[model samples]
Target: MIPTPYPLEEALGIGWYITDTPGTGGVLRKSPEDFAVEEIPLQEPSGSGPYLICRLQKRNWEHQHAMKTIASALGISHRRIAWAGTKDKNAVTSQYISIYGVEEAAVEELRIKDIVVRPVGRNQHPLSLGLLEGNRFAITIRDCTAADTAATVAACTAAAAVGFPNYFGLQRFGVVRPVTHLVGRHILQGDYEAAVMTYVALACPDEDEEVRRIRTEYRETLDAKAAIAALPRHLGFERSLLSRLAEAPEDHAGALKNLPPKLLSMFVSAYQSWLFNRVLSMRLADGVGLDDPVSGDRLLFENGREDLVTETNRRLVSVHLSRGRCAIAVFIPGSEGARIEGKSDERMAMILEEDGITAEDFKRAADFVGLRYNGALRPIAVKSEIQSGVLETDVSLAFTLPPGHYATTVCREFMKADPRAMI
Candidate 1:
């Protein structure tokens, strides 16, 4: 079997590849047009309502930065803008956004380089995260090194028909610095000082050399004022944290609180995601199959209902699975109301025990951050109807996945190269 790159992939708990065929080694996102994403909205906007919905098409723009820029042009708070999902910065993406108390004319008049906004309709309520049905992706992998790209693509496509592990992709953690989970772990442990420091001072080799040097210096000095002056203006979030600490150096928790609530909450959620990845990988290493549920597994139905598999109903569950009724799910632990039964839960508990964390820690983090971590179930595997084409040395793939799934997760199975190349 093809193995994932060491250190980074192994650290993320993505240990193995399902297909044994050689990967069509390639680089992705050579340009913005190479990776395209279009949102499939769940509900269309009505013609008359309080909130004006618009279609946003952007290239080479980070999600939060693009929203903030639009909000500035509209003379409204960035909080007034909402979207169904966050798109990649270095890609051509089209999605819908809702602007509160704005007219179609205002949106039509606004303009920005490499960004287009067109009014779609109006809705009674504003869009919220995960409001879309899913996303459609058209991605091209260029400069492939494989001798027979068609054979490699065919092998991966056939294996993907059964399903692949649903590990959260690299984007969940910061692609450049992969330290969101580290900050999250400190937050859950109630060590706000470490959380703040980790966010501000942790350096990654993938980042610019000057930025890395500055972060390393700050890590050594712990002088927020000096670091604030040294940090570039583009590093706004880091500056915001340091600005707070520069005044009251002991106020680590308060500095963390200065961050947007959604972003702050994401830190803790990333930790939960890391734990889920570990459990999923461990299950795979044990030789568990993804096509059907075995005894002591939790089966998640499409309608959000869950049932446990037992010897009595394993056959029935298998039949329903074949009919696309439900899928095997692994529990993502939370502070409260989380399912703690089944082999998956046992593995999760074992990991938590080894890490010296407990359910109570998550509860405390929720209380501190003013966000709820009530737990949820995620499918262990996901399947898609993939369409692929190979042109000379480049291969293109088109597929749609349910909301909260990552396209890179599918791409990785085909590339089998360094995660950095995919980014």
Candidate 2:
């Protein structure tokens, strides 16, 4: 099995490449180029029973940062910013920041420098988390080569005609995704607080115990193999055991058997990431990236973006390409099953049992969606050019990936394209 997450195994392992070189220049997502930046302006009524005007901007400042910036700006707390999903950094992005407690009459008028305020209808609560419907993109890829410009346009035409591969982009793994795993271990331990502290909060000027521990431990000189061995041996493959106990801890003895499964899973996932990275790195060493863009290539960006997905409870989103023989129809889980009279009753029994969802649910979900998970590898191609030696063309072609997947794994060619670009 190619170590890509189960969701993308077929697409990743299929050997294919589509040209990434976009046309000389263009608006929106033309062939060969994806959105350079995404922006949105959020305005929701503060769920505090009355409207209280709160404001926001990108948390990281210079460009589109994390989706969490919305929470940071309003001082409403990161937990409050309901986003459809996350966006890439290092690009220009602008998204909405709705305020609570503001008068219904005032929402149309509030304005800030880069932040825009719009009045979304009243909400019993601030938008629930992960509530974006989807997003529209405004992309830009500059610095086209005079020699390759014509060829680039042809490639874009081909890509549009053939539909670029729906491969995940590199951003799936953060600047240092490996770390998210090692420490995310604590989160699995049922210490969500620790996971947040160690993974996301350590970089903050204000550090916590978990943050300090990770920083100090990580800073100390150590080898990867030794580090892996040093991890708590007691925490091995305990997810099932611990999760079972978490579901039923009425007995002290049984509950005691539960180790920090959440933390361990974090470790497992991180270690998985490490393993994939090493393999990817080895592939690069074996001469993989020559035909692809290197990580050190020219970097570009635009502004922030707003959320497009309006809801998430039960969503059926289908992304059709402007060109090519590709498209995806995604649905929220729980819509399919075996329909032999009593099958529905049996399926309902499963849902009521220990497992939150049933196999029948998955089957019916697929049936209702009307699209088979055919496991076809999407085709993608990329090209790179060096001009005037000013550090040009570091861009690539990619797709939106859900959580728990590696963007680099999809861009295996690109990762191997330049030995130095391995995640």
List RMSD in Å for every model shown: 1.6, 15.0
- Tens digits of per-residue lDDT for model 2, 1-423: 112222222221223334444224322223223333233223445454543333333322322233233334444443333433344444333344434444645544544344444554555554422344333333333343334544654445344333333333434323333244434234223444344334422442233444444335533532223333443432232222323333552332233223332223223233223323332323333343322222211111112111122133113211212221222211112223222222212323333243343444334323422323221111222222212111244234434332323233333322223211231
Q: Rate the local accuracy (lDDT) of all candidates.
A: 0.87, 0.33
Q: Which ten residues in a row have the lowest lDDT in candidate 1?
A: 1-10
lDDT of 1 by residue, 48-159 (tens): 8888999999999988778878999999988788888989988999999999998889899998999999999999899987889999999999999997889999988887
- TM-score, prediction 1: 0.96
Candidate 1 residues lying further than 4 Å off, grouped into runs, are: none
**Candidate 2's TM-score:** 0.39
Model 1, C-alpha of 134: deviation from truth (Å): 0.3
